[model samples]
Target: MPPKAKSKKKGGNVKSSTVMDGLSTEDMSKDQLEEHIIHLREELDREQEEKSYFQLERDKIQAFWEISKRNLDKTKAELRNRSRERDEAEERHRVEIEVFWTVTGIHATLNFNEIPSTGTGPMAPQHDGTATKWYCG
Candidate 1:
């Protein structure tokens, strides 16, 4: 067996070394080796438990992100549909206004306000003592 190398201790503090640097199992006493193995096993178990917890949290966050993305997509689609409907309604209203103006122009050109009335209905007297003419049509 090789000689044990001297470890450096700062300020007379004894810091326990977890790693065995080039030291064989035969160099350590039975009790020391067993204690080192137990410490290593506990550290490994703690690391594994922490990893599992982080994985669970990551999965939950991923699921929530997916649901939020779907809701956002649905909301965007609804907004687009409403905007298209509003545009169509505006187009219909513009066409209705154009048709109304066209019909009014035609009625004005026909001069339908000056239709002569028959004398069978009652007539009012004018300033000259003549019956006033009334347009009925």
Candidate 2:
């Protein structure tokens, strides 16, 4: 029988899965492998510490964002209330002005004949048959 051909894996190129898997045990001594393992473990520890620090920073930023968003919502609500108050006050002022003008026009017309121009009051207008003159105290 012919020598069996070397079996080949039928797939895409695959690398060894572990940190030490790619290293050749035949080339490296036991002490070298142990030292490499220690270094890899230290590097993993440092990376884990850095990851934790970044996670804390992200949490802090999220808290700040929550506070800022709450404040913004509160400010928007206050602004809306203030705007409503302003609109209501302006409407009341407009109505007051209209009523005052209406009452003034009617009062002036009705009280025109009750004034004695010469000696009655300060609001009386003096007439000399041609032009009317007003005097103020």
**The best candidate in terms of TM-score:** 2
Model 1 global lDDT (CA atoms, 0 to 1)? 0.68
Q: TM-scores for all candidates?
A: 0.57, 0.60
Q: In candidate 2, what are the lDDT values of residues 1-137, reduced to their tens digit?
A: 99999979879786653436576645667798788779889999999999999999999999999999999999999999999999898778667756976887633223344454656565357665555554432
For each candidate, the alpha-carbon lDDT, in order, equals: 0.68, 0.73
Candidate 1's residue-wise lDDT over 1-137, tens digit each? 99999988678865464447566666788887998799889999999999999999999999999999999999999999999999898778667756976887633123323444334632222222333432222
The alpha-carbon lDDT assigned to residue 82 of candidate 1 equals 100
Tell me the lDDT of candidate 2: 0.73
Off by over 4 Å in 2: 1-26, 106-137
Best by lDDT: 2
**For model 1, the run of ten residues with the poorest summed lDDT:** 121-130
lDDT of 1 at 8: 80
RMSD of 1: 17.0
